[model samples]
Every structure is written in structure tokens, then in C-alpha cells.
Target chain A: MIELEGLTKRYGEKTAVDHLTFTVRPGIVTGFLGPNGAGKSTTMRMILGLDRPTAGDVRIDGRHYDELKDPLTSIGALLEAKGAHPGRSARNHLLCLAQSNGIPDRRVREVLDTVGLTAVARKKAKGFSLGMGQRLGIAAALLGDPRILLFDEPVNGLDPEGILWVRTLMKSLAAEGRTVFVSSHLMSEMALTADHLVVIGQGRLLADTSMADFIARNSRSYVRIRSPQRERLLDVLHQAGITAVESGDGTLEVDGDKAEHIGELAARHQLVLHELSPQQASLEEAFMQLTAESVEYHAHSGTPVSPQQWGDDWKKG
Target chain B: MATVQVVRSEWTKIRSVASTVWTLSLAVVVTIALGMLISALARSEFDRMSTQDRITFDPTFISFAGMSLGQLAMIVFGVLVVSNEYSTGMIRTSLAAVPQRGTFLFAKLAVATVLGLVVSMATSFAAFFLGQAMLGEHRASLGDDGVLRAVIGGGLYMTLIAVFSMGVATMLRSPMLSLGILVPFFFLISSILGYVDATKDVVRFLPDHAGSRIMQVVPPVGDDTPYGPWGGLGIMVLWVLAALVGGYVLLKRRDA
Candidate 1:
């Protein structure tokens, strides 16, 4: 378990992390979501005691990071893929870290095999691909088999196979009752893997809720309908007290999951319906909606800034 | 965490890198090879030396002349040992493994210092014996007054050079910047200042000048140095201590 209270980090005049308070509990994958420069990396560094917080406290398993006996055995973190020395072999890199925490040498080899890098374990890290380097970092984090694991952008440079492998690994680790905290800007990936989410925007907490609840609250889901007899469909819907808006693509959009009711009304009126589909907003759209205001870098390509119906624009673009 | 575990870990770190082997070997080869060459040269030119030069001729000190060049390699070794962590982005992982900043820094230093001492002592003994062989008749025996102290001091001097470099590297945190300052300061600037009459007094207090006094068996003619051999070494040690303290304080306060 990792607990942060009133955590803040400021660099001179600029505030990097502002009053972040959240608890990452065990038995689930907690996704840390934020836009670029949103302070996810800074917060992780503070939890490991690598960065000194400007104001606040972070604890791992109810004790300060430095006070933990063999801290690696309590919490393991993979902060960056290129953390190993270029000249040192993968085995030796893990060996030194293992030795530091009194972890045995055998465990180093075990982690090597676990990460599927045993064949290249003797090779220097400089020669490894970015995906391979990420595997090595994960091996280091799993060296002590700690109860809590933290990975920052774990699948950044991975192949499709590697991405699936990492997603499955994170889920299995969480299923074993370990607290798995991962940070990424990819909301689609988080929607697939994360059970809970802690989102931030411009260094401030935007939402801390379950994945299902977050999407339900921040996004709009509607039913899209297209018909040959548009006037007849509009009249039946107006009589039934249903309001429908005509989209730019000649489709009528009704708010909420009223597809079944609309479909029954169209059938009763003998309306020839070309299409009837319920459109549920993805986590990506929900994330954009939540962070639209706090996004630091805005693309100047005349993209719509409003969150309400930007999904259509995004799809068209 | 026990200090010994971190120490063991540091030993693994130092030994695993190729830089450790090549740098120390270069120091050994350069120190020994250069000492022998200079000793042979001095032996051939002995007859043409001035009477005053003959009076104050120090055979022990002449053999260790290669140290001026050889110590640069020691500096490189020391700088890389500490700065590699920062350069390769390994410091974050290392700090995460051992969050106690003091223990982490000191444990690495302790391991590197021990290795430096062992290699330096061996190189010192080799250079002394080989240079004496080249000098032939003018060779100073180990049993001679102050000869053994000078020999042992030669090893201590080399090891201290490496340790001092480690301290400075920790503070500077960049191999290029640390080497940029340390290499020229010790190799060119210190020697040039020592030669100039106006700067000679102040230069003596510098780490290298103060530390090298231990290798002199016979003081130079017109020598007016205020400190004894041990006193000079003590001054160098003080400089090392200051650098280490500054490094520790910075490491404690700054984010990794």
C-alpha cells in the first residue's frame, strides 16, 4: 500500500505537483492518468524517496521510504527503461541490486527468466532494444518480489506482443493481491487494464474513482439512428416526448440508451430504419473531456476545444 | 539496511564495469614504465649534474616521477566510478534500492577506495623496485633512512589522489566537468604555479603539492617548506574531507 497526503513539488516559480493526495490500495491495478507534464513521474519519484517533496508526506506500507528495512523488498519501482549501466550485463545489473537488499543471486536469474531475457542476460544493456530494456527494468522491479510494484510508461516502446504481455502481467500481479500502480497517458490501454483510476490535470487531482464510474460520469453516451423516413421518425419521437438532434452526417442522435424504445416506436409506426446503434463513449473520450481544460500543450490545427461533441470531430479528423 | 550489504553491492558494481580494469591497469603501466625511463635518464646524466644537485639528489623521489602523468588515470577511474551512476540514469534505481543517502554514497566510496589502495600499493612497489634497478649504483635501498616511509607514502599518495577525485566527482556530478577541472588543475596549473615565484607559496597549500611531499626522501636544496611530510599529507586529507562533506550535503538535499 502506498499513501500520499498533501504531496506537492515546486521548482522555483513553477509548481510541478500540487497537493496530490491518494491511496493506492492492494488487490487491484490503479492507473495514474495525466496529460504530458502533469507530474505523474514526479509523484512516483517522491514515493520512492528519490525526489524530496516540497510540502507533504508519502509512505510505503505505513512507514517512510528510508525507514523501511530493505525497502526494495517492500516496494519495487521501474521508473525508466534505461536505468541500467550500458557497460554492465543484464545479469550483473540485477545482481548488484539484489545484493544491495540482501536478495540472493538465484533470484536474479529467476527474474531474468521471468522477464524472458535469460538468453540475453549476459549481454550489455546498451545493445538491447528499447523493448528489451523495458523487460530488464521489469526484471529489476520483480527481483525482490515485493508486494507493491510501480511501473511508469511500461509499454511505451513495445511491440504488440510485448504490450499484451505487459498488460497480462500487470493484471496477474494485481490478481495475486499485490498493489500495482502504473502511470500512462494512454487511456485506451488503461481502460483495458486498470480497475481503478487516479487522474490528474495540470498537477491537480481531477478524479479518483472506479474505472466504470469515471467513464459514466465524465462522458456522454447516446443512441444514433438513421432512417429513410426522417420526418415520420421525428414526428413519432416528438409525440413520445423524445428529443432528437440531427448530426452533421444525416443521423439523428438521442441522449441516453433509448435505442430499444426508439426501435419499438419505429416498428409500431412501420418506419424503415436504415440503422440503429447505441454509441457508448470510450475511456479516451472521457479522459479528453476531463483534461481538456488543463492540457498544457494545445495543438493549433483548428481542432475543436469543446469536450461535449469533440468525439465526432476527432473521428472525422 | 546493513552497511555491509551495500558495501558488497558496491563492490559488485565497481568490479562489473570494464572501466575499472582498464583505468587501473593504465595507471599501473604508466607509473611503472615512466619511472624506469626517468631513472635511466637520471643515471646517465648524473656525471654532468651540478655539485649542489648531487648533494640533494633524491633517488626515491626520482623513480616516482611518473606519478604526475599516471595519477590522471587514477582521476579518471575515480570520476567514472561515481559519475557513471548519474550519467547512465542509474542513480534513480540505485537510490530506490538504498534510500539512505549517506549509506549509499559512503558504501560506494569505501569499496572504490579499498580497490584503489590495493592497486596503487602494488604499482608503487613495482615502480620503486624497477626504477632502482635502472638507477644501478645511485639506487636508494629500502633500509636507508626514510626510504621505506617514502615508498609507502608513494602508495598512499596515489590512493589519496583517486579518493580525492571521487570526492570531487560526487560534488560536480559530471565526468566531463570534473575531469575538465581536475585534470588541468593537477597536471598543468599546479605545476605551472609551483614554478612561478609569485604563486609558489600559495601553490604549496594545494592538494597535489602538499600531498607529494611524502615521497621526498631528501629535501630539495634551499627547501623552506613549513610542514613536515606527515603534515603535508594531513593537509591533503583535509581537502579530501572537505570535498566529501560538500558532496554528502548536496546529495542529501538534492533530488536524485
Candidate 2:
């Protein structure tokens, strides 16, 4: 498990990471989500003991990374895919990292085979494609069979098949009772792969909840009704706890009411309801709503800022 | 044993890189080729002299005459060894693998030191014999006084220069910048420093000045410093320590 207490980092005048506290439990894949410049990378670096925190501390398996007997075995990290010396051969590159962490030499070949890099192990890293370099980075991370793994943007530049492979690999590692924490800005993938979600924005924690709870608590439910007498239904829904408004077509839009509730209400009122259905919020929409604020370095383009623009302020419990 | 493995890892990394081979080869070729050309010209000058004006050319001098050019190439090779990690964003991986920064530095020192030793030895032997063959009459062997010391000193001086360059790389953390400053400062400026009385005191501590002093059979003309050959080389070693320590201090205090 990994834990952070009051952790913070300041780059000159800007506070990149604020005083934040959280825990990453074992036996599950925890996805860290944030907008660009949201401090996810900074936090991970602090966890790995690469960058010193301006305040507080981070611990892995109850000890700092430097205090671990063998850091590679304790925690395998793919901090950046382009982390190897470009001049070194793939095989020799892994060999050097393995040797530094006291890993046996056999593990080097095993990881190369696991990642399907054995074919190009003798080739220099400068020659490898981005995908191949990513594979090498993953191979190095898994070389020690670590109990805790940290992957920062691991799915970037991967093809569809490669993405699926990584998703499955993360799940399997967590299933084996290891702590798997992966960070990415891609919400679609996180919704599919992560059992737990840790969301941050503008250098502060926004949400720390199980995927199920997050969806259930934050998502919106609505009712859509199609009827020739849409005006009558609108008046009737207004009397009920649900809010209803006229749709562009001859239909009624009911807010905070499910299909069954609207149907029963219509039946009791003896109204002719042509259509009654529930509209559920997608995980993607819920995520946008939760992290509506704290986005830094916004891209100016034709695309609209997510509905999160509606939520100018966010809070976490 | 772990440190030994670290050293081995550093060696593999250095050898696998093509720059290591290219730069070291440049060190050898430039040293030998330049020595041959320079020694031949000096001998031609000796032959035309009147009998009374004959100034005997030192045999060891002509053989190791290429020290000036050889040192520059070795310096390039040394700087790249450490600086490439920073330029390519690989130091994060390196430090992550071996959390103990000291171990990493030690491994680099060992790999760079050994490679420097090997290249210097090759260039020394090749330049000495080739230059002697070029000198039709004036030839010196290892058996002569200070001839053995000078031959070994030539190689030793080149090795120290490489190590000194490694320290500069660590401090500067960029190959181009380190080599840019090191080359002109050592090759052009240090020798010129001797001409000005005010700069002479500081020039005594210049790495190439102290290191190049070892190659001289007798101190070069207009020399003001009192350091003998070994003591001068010792000053170069002192330079290596200063740079390594400076880098370490910076690495310790700064954010990774």
C-alpha cells in the first residue's frame, strides 16, 4: 500500500501540489485521474522519492522508498517510457537496471520475453519505436516482480491491442494482491480498468471514492416522456417532487425522476403517457462533473470545455 | 558485490554506446597522427642546424608530442558518458534503479577511469613507436633516463584528463556545454595564461596545465610554476576531486 500525508511541492512561487493526504490500498487497481498540470506526476515522483516534498511525506509498504531493502522489488515504476539511455542496447539496458537493484540476471531475460522484446533485445534503444520503448520500460518495471507498481501515462502511444493488453495486465496484477496505481487523463480507459478512483484537480484532491460509489453518488438520473398532451404532464410533474419542462418536440423532460416513478405517477393521474424512460448519467459525464474546476493549461480550440465548466468550484470529503 | 555489479552495469552501458568508441578512437588517431607530423617537422629543423647550434631533440618528446590534440578528444568522450543521461531524460531511470546516488557516481567513475586507462595506453604505445620510426636518426627507448616515466606519464596524463572531463560533465549536466567550455579553456587559454603575470598564479591550477606538465621531459619555455611532473599531475587529480565533489553537492541540494 502507498500512503501520503500532507504532501506538497512548490516550484518557486507556484504550488504544484498542495497539502494532500490519501491512501492507495492493495489488491485493487486505483486509477489516478486529473487534468494537465494537476500535480499527478509530481505526486508520483514524490512517492518514488525522486523529488523531495516541500512538506509532509509519502510512504510505500510502510517505509520510504529509500528505506526499502530493494526498491525495485518493493515498487516497480514506469515513470517515463523514454527513461533508458538511447545508446544502450535493449538487453544491456535491462541488464544494468537489474544489476543495480540486486536482481538476478535470469530475471532480465524473463522480463524481455514477457514483454516480447527478446527479438530486439540486442538492438540499440535509439532505434526502437515509441511502442517498443514503452514495452522495454514496462519490462524493466516488472523485472523485480514488485508488489507495488506505479505507471504514469502507460497507455500513451499504444495501439488498440496494446491498450487492451495493458488493461488486462493491470487487472491481473491487482488480482494477485498487489497495489497497482496508474495515472492518466483518459477517463474512458479509467472507467473500464480501475476498481477505485483517485481524482485530483488544480493541485488538490477532488474525490477519493470507489468506482461504484462515485458513479452512484455523483451521476444524475432523469425521465423522458413522449405524449400528445405534453403540457398536462408538465403541470402534473411540477406538482410532484420532480421538475418537468417542455421539450422542443411534443414531449416532457422530467428531472430527478426514474421511468418507474414517472410511469406510476402518470397511471395514478390517469394521463395518456406514450413514452416513459429513464436516462442514466454516463461515467464520463459524472467524472467531468466531479472535476469541473482546477483544470490548468486549458487548450484554446473549437472544442467546448467539458460540462465541468458548469462546476466552477469543487470540494471533496 | 552490489557495487561490482553496478560497475559492470556502467561498463556495459558505456561500451554499448557508439560515442564511447568514436571519441576514444579520435583520441588515439589525433594523438598519434598529430605527434608524427609535429615530430617530423621538429627533426627537419634539427637536421638543418649548424653543428654548434644543434639542440638535441628529446626522443620521448616527439613520440608523445600529440598530447594537446589527444587530450581534447578524450575530454569529449568523458563528458558524454555522464551528460547523455541528463540530455535524454534517463537520469531519472538511473537514479530510480539505484536509489543510492553515491553508488551510481562510483560506478561511473570506475567505468570512465578504466576506459580512459585503456585508450591512453593504446595511443601511448602506438604514437611512441610510430613517431620513433619517423625520426630517422634521433630515437629514444624505454631504457633511457626518464624515457619510461615519460612514456607512462603521457598515457597517465591522458587518463587523468578524461576523468577530469567526467567531473565537468557531472557538474554541467550537458555534453555540448561541458566540451565547449573545456576544449577552448584547456587547449587555447591555459597556454596563453602563462604570458600574463596576473593569470599565472591561477593557471598553475588549470587541469590541462597541471596534467600536460607531466608530458614535458624538461618544463616548457617561459614556465614559472615550480611543480615537478608527478606533483603537477597530482594537481590534475585534485581538479577531478573538486569537480566530483561540486557535482555531488549540487545533486544533494537540488530537486531531482
Candidate 3:
């Protein structure tokens, strides 16, 4: 487990991370969610004892990372994709880091094979592509076979197959009772992989809860029904004490009713329904909603349109 | 000890980098080859000169003429060993692995010292043999007066100079800056001091000037400021120690 208490980091007049206190528990994948520049990387570095926290401390498995006699065996991290030396061969790179923490030399080959870089292990890292470099970084992290793992933006440059591989790897790692803390701005990816969520905004802790609980509070769910007699469907929903809004597509968006209940109501009303589908707020929509005002860097492309405006055409039956 | 581990890691790191091997190889080849060329030319020139000018032909310094040029290559080798770490961003990984800043510098110096000794010894030996062969009948055997002394002092002195170069490299992390400062100090300041009578007293104590006294046959032309061969080596050793301490202090006080 990794624990942070009142952790803070400031750069002169700017605060990078502010009073971040959270426990990243074991046996599950905890997603650290934030928009760009929300201090996820800063917090991870603090946890690894790379950056000195301005106010408080972070501990891994009940001890500070540096104080641990062999930290690599307790916590593995890929804080930056380019952390490895470019001149060293991938194998030698792993070997040096392994030796530093008393890890056996055999572990280097194991991690290289595990990451599917065995064929290119002898090649210098300067020749690696972004995805290849990310794999090497992950290989280094797994070299110690530690109980805790931290990855920041692990899937940034991966292909579809590589993305699936990373997602599965993270899930399996958590299933083995390891504490896996992954930071990403891709909420869609995290929603599928992370069992729990810790959302931060502008360097402050905004939410820390199970993924289910987070969605329940921050996301909205409803049913969309389009019928020849849309007005009749609306009337039936209002009479049943269900709030229905007339969507831009001329459909009745019925809230407070499941898709099954809405279908049964339309059947009873003898409405010729063209469409009846359940719609839950996607992780992307929810993320945008939660972090709208707190986004650190706003795109200056003039007139920012809402996500709903962009996705409304696809919402039509 | 963790320091030993760091030293081992540093050894692996420096040796693994291709430039380390290349630089050291160039230093050896350049030293030996240049020593042969200069030795042959010196013998021919000495033979052609009038007998009156032959009094200045002290063969000891002539045999090690390569030291003047070879030291430049060794200095380049020394600077790159440290500066390349900074250029490639490997220093961050190294520092992160071994967070004790002073210990890291010690390990780096230890690696450089061992490498310096090996390269210096190899180059010195090769240069001496080639120089001796080029001198023909002008070459003095090891049994001659102070001949063995010059041979031993030649190799040992070169090693000390290389160590001094490595120390300076550590103090100035930028290889080019160290080279810029080291070359002028060796080729310019010391030579200009040699032409004058007054400043020679202080300038002889400077790193290269005082150290090269070990390789000379006569007592540094005309001066009472001359130290014994071992004493000259001691002066260079002092310079190395002082550079190392200053490097350590800077490392400890600065952020990586």
C-alpha cells in the first residue's frame, strides 16, 4: 500500500500538488484521474521519494521509499518513459537498475521476455519508438517483481493491440494482490481497467471512492424513446411521476425509469415506438462535467462547444 | 559498502558507453604514433646541427616528447567520462540509484582513476618503446645514468597527469569548458612563464609545469625552483586532491 498524508509540492509561486492525502490500497487497480496539468505525475514522484514534498510525506508499505533498504522489491515505478539511458542496451539498462537494488541478474532476462523485447534486448534504447520505449520502461518496472506498481500514461503511444495488452497486464497485476496505481487523462480507458477512482483537479483531491460510487454520484443515466406518438409517451411518463425531457431529436428522454420500465409503459400506452434504448453517461462525459471549470489549460481555439453538442447527432435513434 | 556498489555501477556505465573505449584508444594510438614521429625527426635534426648546439640534446625529455601532445587526448578522454553523463541524461538515473551525492562523486572518481591508470600506463609504455626505436644509436639503455629513472618516472608521471585531468573534469562538468581551461594552462600560460625569469617561481608550481619537471633530464633549464622527480609528481597529486575535494563540495551542495 502507498499512503500520502497532507502531501504538497510547490514551485515558487505555483503550487503543483496541494495537500494530497489518499491511500492507494492493494489488491485492486486504483486509477488516478485528472486532466492535463492536474499533478498526477508530481504525486507519483513524491510517492517514489524523487521529489521532496513541501509539506508532508508519502510512504510505501508503511515506510518512506528511500528508507526502505531495498525499495525496488517493495515498489516498482515507471515515472517517465525516457528514464532509461539511451546509450545503454535495453538488457544492460535493466541489469544496472536491477543490480542497484540487489535484484538478481536473471530477472533482467525475465522482464525483457515478459515485455516481448527479447529479440531487441541487445539494441540501444536510442533506437526505440515511443511505444517500444514505453515497453522498456515497463520492463524495468517489473524487473524487481515488486508488490506495488505505478505507471503514468502507459498507453499514450500504443497501438490498439498494445493498448489491450497494457490494460490486461494492469488488471492481472492487480488481481495478484498488488497495489497498482495508474495515472491517465483517458477516462474511457480507466473506466474499463480501474476498480477504484481517485480524481483530482488543479492539484487538489476532488474525489476518492470506488468506481461504482463515483459514477453514481457524478454521472447521469436515462432512457431514450422515439415513437410516432412521442407526445403520448411523454404524457404517460409524466403521469407515472417520471421526468421526461423532449430531446433535440424529437424523442422523449425519460429519467427515473429503466429501459424495461419505459418499454412496458409504451406497450401499455399502445405507442408505436421507433426506438427505446438505455443511455448512461459515458466516463468521458462524466469526466468533462466534473472537470469543466477546473481544467488548467483551456484550448484557445475560440468558442468551446459542449460535448453534448458534439455527441447529440450520434444520440439519435 | 554502498559506495563500492556505486563504483561498480559506475565502472559498468563508463565502460559500456562506446565513447569511453574510443577516446582511450585514440589517446594511446595518438601518443605512440606521435612519439615515434617526433623522436625520429629530433634525432635527424640533432645529427645535422653543429657540434656546439649538441650540448642541449638531453635525450630523456626527447624520448617522452609525446607527453606534451598525449596529455591533450587523455584530458579529452577524462572530460567526456563525466560530461557525457550529463549530456545523455544518465546522471539522473545514476543519482537516483545512489542518492548520497558525495558517495556518487567518489565512485565516479574511482572509476576514472582506474581507467586513467590503465590508459596512461599503456600509452606511456608504447610511446617510450617507439621513441627508443626511432632514436637508433642516440637511444640510451636503461643501464645508463638516470635512464631507468626516466623510464619509470615517465610512465608514473603520465598516470599522475591523467589523474589530475580527471579531477579537473569532475570540477568542471562541461567537457569543453574543462578542455578550454586545461589546454591553455598547459600550452600557453606555462610556456609564457618559461620565457620570463620573474613569474617562473610561481608558474612552475602550476599543474602541468610543476608535474612535467619529472620528465626533464636537466633541472628545468635554469632555475632553483626545480623539485625532485618524485616531488614534482607530488605537486600534481596535490592538484588532483584539491580538485577532487572541490568537486565533492560542489556535488554535495548542488541539486542534480
Candidate 4:
């Protein structure tokens, strides 16, 4: 269990992390979600006591990080992939860390095998590929078999197979009643792996809720309709006290789960409907809408067109 | 955690890297090989020297002549032992494992210093025997007055040079920047300053100048140095201590 209360970090005139307070509970994979530069890395560093916090407190398993004897057995972290000496072999890198905490040397070989790097364990880290380096980092994190594990951007450079492997590993680790806290900016990835979500935007807490609740609250679900008798369908919808929005592609979108009602109405009027499908907003859209105002860097090319303009242009046509 | 565990861990860290072996071996090989070459050259030119030069000539000191060039390798070893953590982003993982900053830094320094001392002692002893063989008739034996102390001090001087570099590297935190300043300061600037009458007094206080005094078993014919061999070493130790304390203060106060 990792607990943070009123955590804040500032650099010169800029605030990097602001009053972040959240408890990462055990028995689940809690996703720490934020845009780039939203202080996820800074917060993880503070949790590990690598960086001094400007204010507030952070604790792992009811003790300060530094105070914990054999900290690896209490909490293990993979902060970045390049955290080992480039000239040292993978086995030696793990050995040094294990020896520091009085862990047995035999565990080094075990972890190397666990990460599937045993064949290359003797090779220097400077020669490892990005995915191989990441595996070595994960091996380091699992060296002591700690109860709490923290991973930052674990899937940054992984192929699809490697991604699935990590996703399954995280789930299994959580199932074993360990607190698994992983941070990433990929909402679709988090939607698949995270059971709980703690979101931040511009260094402030945006949401702390279950994954189901977050997606349900932030996204819009609607019924989409396309018909050859578009004008007749609009009149029928108006008389039925239903408001439908016309999209640029000539599809009508009603803001509710009214697929059955629309289908019944079309059947009654015998309208020649071409397409009728229910659309629920994806986690990507929900995350974008929630963090749109707080995104630090915005690309100017091909910015999304406003929906109000779509309405105005439709009325003009 | 016990300090012994950290010490063991630091030993593993130092021995696992190729740079540690390469730098220390380079220091040893360069010191011994060059010391023998210089001794042979000095023996050949012995007859051309003035009467006063022959009377005050120190054979033991001549044997360690290669140290002037070899100490740079020691400096490189010292710098890499500490700065590799920063250069490769390993410091974060290291500090996270052992969060007591003082223990982490000191254990690392202690392990490196011990290795430096062992390698340097071997180099010092080997250089003395080989260079004496080259000098033939002018060789100083271990039984001569102050000869053994100077030989032992030669090893200590080399080890101290490496330790001093380690302290500076900790304070600077970049291998490139530390080497950039330290290499020129010791190799070129200190020697140049010692040669000029204007800067000779100040040069005596620099780390290399004061530390090298320990290996001198005989003073020059018109020598006027204020400190004895032990006193000069003491001054160098003071410089090392100050650098270490400064590094510790900065490390404790700053964010990693």
C-alpha cells in the first residue's frame, strides 16, 4: 500500500505536482493516468524517495521509503529502462542491487530467467534492444518479489506480443493481492489493464474513481441512424419528441440509448433505413474530453472542427 | 541495513564494470613501464650531470618518475567510479535501493579507494624494483635511510591522488566535466605554475604538488620547502576531506 497526502513539488517558478493525495490500494491494478508532463514521473520518483518533495508526505506500507529495511522486499519499482550501467552485464546489474539489500545471489539468475533474458544475461546492457532493456528493468523490479510494484511507461517500446505479456503479468501480479501501480498516457491500454483509475491534469487531480465509473461519467453514448428517407425520418423524430443531431456525413445521432425506440419507429413508418447502430464513446474520447483543457502541448495541425459549426453548416444547407 | 551489505554491493559494482579494470590496469602498467624507461635514461646521462646533481640525486624518487603521466589514469578511474551512476541514469536505481545518501556515497568511495590503494601499492613496489634494475649502480635499496617510508608513501600518494579525484568527481557529478577540469589542472596547469617564480608558492598547495612530496626521499641541493613529507601529505588529505564534505553537503541538500 502506497499513500500520498498533500504531495507537492515545484521547480523554480513552475509547479510540477500540486497537492496530489491518493492511496494506491492492494489487490488491484491502479492506473495513474495523465497527459505528458503532468508530473507522473516526478510523483513516482518522490514515492521512491529519489527526489525530495517540496511538501506533504509519501509512505509505503505505513513507513517512510527510506526507513524501510530492505526496501525492495517492501516495494519494488521500475522507474526507467536505462537505470543500469551500460557497461555492466544484465546479471551483474541485478546482482549489485540484490547484494545491496542482502538478497541471495541465486535470486539474480532466477529473475533473469523470469524475464526471459537468461540467454543474454551475460551480455552488456549497452547492447540490449529497447524491449530487452525493459525486460531487464522488470527483472530488477521483481528481484525481491515485493508486495507493491510500480512501473512507469512499461510498454513504451514493446511489440504487440510483449505488450500482451506485460498486460497479463500485471493482472496476475494484482490477482496475487499485490498493489500494482502503473502509469501511462495511453487510455486504450489502461482501459484494458487497469481496474481503478487515478487521473491527473496540469498537476492537479482530475478524477479518482473506478474504471467503470470514470468511463460511464465522462463519455456520451448515443444511437446513430442513417436513412434514404432522411426528411421523413426527421419529421417522425420531431413528432415523437426526440431530438436528433445531423452529422456532416448525413447520419442522425440521438443523445441516448434509444436504438430500440428508433428501430420500432422506423418499422412503424416503414422508413427505408440503411444503417442503424448504437455508439458508445470509447475510453480514448472520454480521456481526451476530460484532459483537453489541461494538455500542456497542443499540435496546431488539423484541429478538430467544432460541433456547433456542424450544426450551423447543416442549417445553412 | 548493515554497512557491510552496502560495502559488498559497492565492491560488486566497482568490479563488474570494464572501465574500472581498464583504468586501474592502465595506471599500473604506465607507472611501471615508464618508471623503468626513465631510470635507464637517467643512468645513461648520469656522467654529464653536475657535481651537486650527483651528490643530491634520489634514486628511489627517480624510479617513480612515470607517476607524473600515470596519475591521469588514476584520475580517470576515480571519476568513472562515481560519475557512471549519473551518466547512465543508474543513480536513481542505486539511491532508491539504499536511500541513506551518506551511506551510499561513502560506501562507493570506500570500496573504490581500497581497490585504488591495493593496485597502487603493487604498482609502486613493481616500479621500484624494475626501475632500480634499470638504474644499476645508482639504485637505492629498501634498507637505506627513509627509503622504505618513501616507497610506502609512493603507494599512498598514488592512492590519495585517486581519492582526491573521486571527491571532486562527486562534487562535479559529470565524468566529462570533471575530467575536463581535473586532467588539465593536474597535468598541465600545476606543472606550469610550479615552474614560474610568480606562482611557485601557490603551486605548492595544489593537490598534486603537495601530495608528491611524500615520495621524495632526498631534498634538492638548495631546497627551501616549509613542510616535511608527512606535513605535505597532511595538506593533501585536508584538501580531500574538504572536497568530500562539500560533495556530501550538496548531495544531501539537492534533489537527485
Best by TM-score: 4
- Each candidate's iRMS in angstroms? 0.8, 1.9, 2.6, 0.9
lDDT of 4 at A122: 93
* Backbone-clash count (model 2): 0
Q: Tens-digit lDDT track for model 1 on B99-210? A: 9999999999999999999999999989999999999999999999998998899899999999999999999999999999999999999999999999999999999999
Candidate DockQ values, in order, are 0.81, 0.62, 0.31, 0.82
Local accuracy of candidate 2 as per-residue lDDT tens digits, A25-111: 999999999877889999998998889999999999889877776688888998754898887888988888887777899999999
Q: Relative to the unseen true structure, what is the C-alpha lDDT of residue B81 in candidate 1, on a scale of 0 to 100?
A: 98
Between candidates 3 and 4, the DockQ winner = 4
| Candidate 2 structure quality by residue, lDDT tens digits, B9-62 | 787788878899899999999999999987788678877866644444466777
- As a whole number from 0 to 100, the lDDT of residue A67 in candidate 2 is 78
TM-score of each candidate structure, all chains considered together:
0.93, 0.90, 0.80, 0.94
Q: Global lDDT for candidate 1?
A: 0.93
The candidate with the higher lDDT, 1 or 3, is 1
Model 1 DockQ class: high
Q: What TM-score should be assigned to candidate 4?
A: 0.94
Quantify all predictions' global Cα lDDT against the true fold. 0.93, 0.83, 0.78, 0.91
Top-down TM-score ranking = 4, 1, 2, 3
Residue clash pairs of candidate 1: none
Candidate 1: where are CA atoms >4 Å away? A226-236, A246-251, A263-276, A296-317
| Prediction 2: B-chain TM-score | 0.92
DockQ of 4: 0.82
